[model samples]
Target: MATHTTFQFRRRMRPHRLALATLAACLGSGLTAPVCAQDAVQTVTISGRNSANAASVAGFGDIPVSRSPFSASVITTRQLADAGIGGLADITRLDAGITDAYNAPGYWGQLAVRGFTLENRSNYRRDGLPINAETVLPQANKQSLEVLKGTSGLQAGVSSPGGLVNLVVKRPTGTVRQLTLGWADDASLGAAIDLGDRSGAFGWRLNAAYDHLQPPTDASRGHSRLLALAVDAQVTPGLLVEAEIESSRQVQPSTPGFSVLGDRVPDAGASDPRTNLNQQPWRLPVVMAGRTGSLRLTQTLGKDLQLSLHAMRQRLDSDDRIAFPSGCSAEERFDRYCSDGTFDLYDFRSEGERRTTDALDVALSGRALALGLAHQFTAGLLFSRHEARFNRQAFNYVGTGRIGALVVTPADPSLTDENTDRDEKSTELRLQDLVVLTPEMSAWIGLRHSRLDRRSERTDGSRPIAYEQSFTTPWLALSHAVGPNGMAYASWGRGVETEVAPNRSRYANAGEALPALQSRQIEFGYKHRTALLDWTVAAFDIRRPTWSDLGPCDSGADGCVRAIDGSARHRGIEAEVEWRAGAWNLRGSAMALKARREGAADAAINGLRPTNVPASSLKVQAAYNVAYVPGLALLGFVTHEGRRMVLPDNSLDTPGWTRLDLALRYAQRLGSRQVVWRAGIDNVANARAWKEAPFQFGHAYLYPLQPRSLHVSAQMDL
Candidate 1:
């Protein structure tokens, strides 16, 4: 990995230069520039709300969440800080509809929404622009995180039917300077600084952070650094230009998961939670670095019309290394470990892996009155290109290791093989409209046409694969205002996804590409809001085609064939509530899901529950301001997850578990500056539980929940 330092450095500098050039061009335009007013005074407000009242993730402009027709939620910066959230896995504690999906320590975050795993390439966005989600995303410079649950065909052309996550970048709000210091019981230390200012039609914001993280696991430690900048200029009264760029790097070793022994689940208390299976002396830490830039231009065409253009570029380079553990020495049984706690180990390493993404979008939005009806509409065109380059990886078998002993496996010395590259291009045209049918009723309709081209090449003498596809997805919804503070709505949508057969020797039709599959979703929901309370309830059903390996190939060989032969249906209900009064604040959410396979070629798997999908989940957070202390508050959180099926055949499962967290905060003024301090303990009871069990690559892996730990932080307005 270190051999490409020069190349990586040169590649990383291009985005910075491009961003600077764009800024210069925007400033040098002939448009007149005027002096702007001074920054306004800042005020503080205490509320129980976890997010803003509106969001734009649904691609219908900034609409009130209470009336948006789909289920959505937002987590604000204040909420994130209060809960000490560091990654996507922690976010599951705030929303019942989201859960973990193979998210391990020191690796990029992965999650599922509504019983479906989100695609890393298409289901994530930054400031409404697409970016690669294959690396660690820094949260120090984020304003809010928005989640849209269910099908998103209108918002994204090709995506998972589960949902999408959009990260809102922090903009230049006003003049401010803040500094923070943090510490954790696991020997982690961090510091951050945020600065922003505005002057005469121009504003800028900068954020930087550095951290040294040491998890509870033995011989596992890492470091991370980040730098981000954002700027905006009001070119004229009706024109605005904004740009942002960020660079970050992280080096950490990934932890391998535990597996079941024979037919029995591993004992939770047998090994310490701090045990790490990948702690071989010859193992190397994974290195990940990324750079991203974005630009936006908005112009007001008229009183009721606006035009906007957006462009984004991202590049990621990573070296993945791990001492992977799988299977056992038992004959005819390679899916689980042996009864003596022995398993086969492999020295795996893949270097010089690169992923890049580029996207551009142009949209027009306005309001009009025609045919005796008021309408709001948006029309847009989107284009995106993604490429991935990889070198043949090393997965040589090493000596076996016992659960409680140190393993000294020698590193593989084989040279890397030829390169493999994948390229994907997509174009989409979208249109959506909201029409007021009556005084209390409205209708929403949307449509999108997408074309995708994908190609892959292997330099190791393997045949190339390519495919082209086109699809049209439609969306419809109807909402009726029950009262001034309540609304009821129903929505239906369709989405598309592309699948390719694995390039393995066991599959007869290996490397074959299939046509895009379609997924459908239907939902009904209601929302109500008041000065002191807000609540929402929704029910949804989603269905999609499932692909798997069926025995007996067309070649008359003793191998399997890969194709779509089944369907998966997921039905669920979700509810959320928030209440704020004089001294107490409460927020909670709950979800119930039923996911099963149907119409399968194999009867043994039909009607079985999907792996890692929970039947029900609940989360709640409460805070109270002490009446006598005036500046002190206490906080508590509770979360519960139902049992989950661990295998495709429904032969193994993990039990349900509940967790509790407690915290406290103190805020006061130091002279003319504001100061705040926070402390929290997660998993206070020290209960050991299996968090998630995901079967991958012909093996089953079990991840344990984090042990009890304490963290503290302090911030000062300087």
Candidate 2:
């Protein structure tokens, strides 16, 4: 690692100092949002020092999470490092109000809130912009993470009513260099390096991290790599120029431990860690590899005015397939008729499943009416383009092995005989205004207009047509400082969504074809904070009763407007409590919510009730500095989820399950605080929890959560 420390550079701050400083910054910055810091911290003998409430991405944490009228969570960088977390899934699993975020039986996990389908906006961002939101993999170059809950048709331009997540990148500072190393159970290995330097009126930073992991089971494997480089320069004092780039890569594969009829459990000693889950693991046919590259440039015109031009392009591709015995018992498979049918033996697989995305967003913000009724106003033009392609092919059509299947056409293995492809593009423009009425009150207004056009590039006559969509939405919010550190806010907004064509095989489909409809929502919440604590509470309602269909309406039809007016309610209570003092910090949240859906003819439709949503959830975490131990810290966190039902057809409710986890860490010294040590265990109870439904598997074909396991990791500066 190459680090440069100058006179402007300072050392790191203590946990207490950082927390108090951050909160103060939030108050002075006009943002009123609160965040939970990571459990880890790295300091430079010449390098450490640091620094909230209803905070928005615009400034300090002055905005409450309840402002979204839904719920939001801010996980700080400090907390992440202290706890030795390496992925987004791990981070989210510990948050309240987030259900089954990644604790599902399958590898591809998602976020569910208040019984609403918030998958589209599941990914998160930083500084108000999405960083690695769409990547199915975890991001390594992040400084902080933000989760926004609600139908964000207002903030994101075009999105579902479910919610959105934002990951803030850890950029370089006007200081020196820092590094960290840690070790944990399961032979986990990790290392991180960050360097910053200032040249006259210019500053630059570089960061990199790598991890190698092996879970208890043979099927669980993980490898991650990340790097980031950025430069900050003041070209002419008034004209400051900055550029940043970041990249991350991850590869993991898990063996499907299918339960014997949902509750099937073999003797623990009889299980073979090395045994391939039947012939499935070997035939996984699931492989994903991709990389994302991003760049940003911003300019400052004045003290209260600045404009940032941002551009980012990402590429992702994956080949996935899963297969199970066609019948439950051997008799059922051959007889073709048996109670509780078998799994799909033909092993449906997707080949050449590739998706590529390119987005360009430009934003400009400054005080239009400098410091009077308004201090800073931000207006920006956003344009995002996404091109996704899908290619599907089947192998071993009727049996477990390739030889037993009939080769309709000899396998050329080079893209031939039976395949499909699809592509889509979207563009949007948004305007946001931040008006500060008085030092005690503030108001936020925003508007967005967007368009979507798509086409299906098929090898056959697959309705190769084009469709366009135009949308305009406006939002308004008011915030007042009740007590010196308390804030109350109310907001109202309209949300709009269109039919997405990538996930589904066909658009303008037949049978249940549905049209696009509009949705609207309104909410209110309050926040309170002191030097040692912060918390919030909110209530909201969202409804969309347009004759519409975004996906296969259970009948493989597109453009079908069969009275599909779907309305959902998000009424809940969210709160966070934190206490910080010398060497000790404790924080956590308790959340409760109710989500209801209307406008469905059949109670067993399977597509209603916001598939995979939980009614109640809770989480708690605590940390303590072992000043006596010098460089040693202790940590613990736990999360829980309430019962949820099945909604594949919006027909029935699935059995509910609860899960628990425990973690601990120890930090020592290495390279000027660059290197370190740590270890811990998860799923302490070794208990089982099903995060999703069985779909066709059965009424309760549980999605079994992970069994208790141990993991360890380490990092070295050099």
**TM-scores for the candidates:** 0.92, 0.78
Q: Cα lDDT of model 1 overall?
A: 0.79
Supply every candidate's count of residue pairs whose N, Cα or C atoms clash at under 3 angstroms. Answer: 0, 76
Lowest lDDT sum, 10 consecutive residues, model 2, at 7-16
Residue 329's lDDT within candidate 1 is: 65
Deviating ranges (above 4 Å) for candidate 1:
1-52, 413-419, 503-508, 553-559
Q: What are the clashing pairs of model 1?
A: none
| Candidate number achieving the greatest TM-score relative to the actual structure | 1
Residues 1-718, candidate 2, lDDT per residue (tens digit)? 3442211110010001112332233234433434443324422110011114232552222434433233566666545544445555555455676665333322454565544545443134445654334344544456666666666766665566656666666665656556544444445566666777776888877877766655454444566666777776777756656666666665555344333332232223333433323244344534555555556666666565567777666666666555433333444333121233234344556656666666677777655554345434466776666565666455453442221122222222333334545455656677776566766567778787777765554545463546666778887777776757677878777776655333244444432323555666676787765665556667777676534344446775564334454555566776666666677766767677766656555444423444456777777777666766665556666667666554344444544555554444444444564334555555677655554543333323334555555545454433
User: lDDT tens digits, residues 59-129, model 1?
Assistant: 87645576678898777766766676766557888899999888778888788999999988899999888
Candidate 2 colliding pairs, count: 76
